[model samples]
Target: MTNLDFLLPKSSPTDLRSIVWPRPMTVLVTAPHPDDFDAIGVTLKYLKNQGHDIHALVAETGSGIDKVYGAGMTQEEKRQLRVREQTGSLRFFGLPDQNFRFLNLNNAPDDQVVDDEANRLFLEKLIRQIHPDLLFMPHGNDSNRAHRDMANMMKAIASKVEWPIALLFNSDVKTIGMKKDFYVGFDEADAQWKAQLLRYHDSQHQRNLRDRKYGFDDRVLMLNRKTATELGIREPYAASFEIDIL
Candidate 1:
């Protein structure tokens, strides 16, 4: 039997190079909402540093934030605010404007995205156009409807044909069940940098602070810290993911 050390503390440098695609390949990360890209920031940064051609496909404008914050704003105004927040955050991370796109799907009033054929076709066409080697999105078994919807859309696309791609499903606080197959660890410097990057989404930062009594960075870092501790890192941050092929 394999010497399973379930209770033993694992040591590292949580390097993901061994699990990442061996070559410089195109990558697409789908964000169900604007700031989600930051949830897996450490991992995404590592992949970008490795010369992967990464494109971000953001599915929604997070209009719900506007409904609460911008009470009387037009739909376009609400959408643009969310767009500006995400684009600014991406720029802070050194991701060029051309490298990311907003799907701008028509969202329902309660902010839930309608998982219909039109949305599916749009996602399929973009996936075909990008032809990525690796695809990253939130896992399907999540409490958040939008995240689950995004995963469902991808699964549908994958089912239509034999896609030669690797799917990387990352976790956040709302994720219900996930298996952490791979991870990337970050030290103090990286953690501080990620915090700054996350702050670019000021709406989310303020909202989190108001609701949770902590900033958005704090909330995300809390998850990272928990993952690091669970993985046996004494005092650092880590982001984990489960990998699947489709």
Candidate 2:
């Protein structure tokens, strides 16, 4: 017997479609950096196909790529490149430029902290203006500091707001552990598109190769397959999310 057989029950698993929202709801997906969207690209595409008004919000300029990757380019140049790539990827996913918003906050070093008040205000304003019915953000326990901080900030902002919105936590590649409340399965076509969308983040892909890390395409597909298998899904690809009503 396989590991899944041991972890999961012997009986057939129930199809948990409890998190499916009503049609045509607005969705806002938050990313700490440009390429981070790969974490939820599949689910975002699925929502878009369902005719939901979807928008992408990138919190940081991703200027720190020069430090993590190589040092050939200036921070400004790296930020611009990431922005262009992000725009291209969103466009490919059928989201127009107008639907994308960028908050050009500086990416602080490991020992330093960013301006929390400014970040909070930025997110609060967006939430007030867009008023998304559904919000997708990185899991709070993500290994990446930026992602973790963003998740916390989002939760804090949501708590302060009086609006009724659904919070869905997307699992990050940097996340070591996750508690998934639901899984969104995708067909081969959608999976292919997600892979294609990830390729648009050329700098990130190159950095992964240079650092000897798993390629974005392989990592995402592997995570999806693993999630689907654990959820007892017949299909082999899915994105998992933890849900909360706020």
The candidate maximizing lDDT is 1
104-189 per-residue lDDT for model 2 (tens digits): 75557642225488878878898889988778888888677777888888788888877767777876667777777667787788
- In order of appearance, the predictions have TM-scores of 0.88, 0.85
The residue-by-residue lDDT of candidate 1 on 1-246, one tens digit each, is 111122112333334655434468788898888888978877788889988887999866655463456677876676678789888889888898889998877565656565778889888898888887678899999988888888888877866754566677887989997988777888889899899988888877887877789998999999899889988855488888876666
Error of 2 at 125 (Å): 1.1
Per-candidate Cα RMSD to the true structure, in Å, reads 5.2, 6.7
* Residue pairs that clash (backbone atoms under 3 angstroms), model 2: none
Q: Which residue runs does candidate 2 get wrong by more than 4 Å?
A: 1-23, 63-71, 110-115
Residue ranges of candidate 1 with Cα displaced over 4 Å? 1-15, 64-68
Write down the TM-score for model 2: 0.85
Clash count list over all predictions: 0, 0
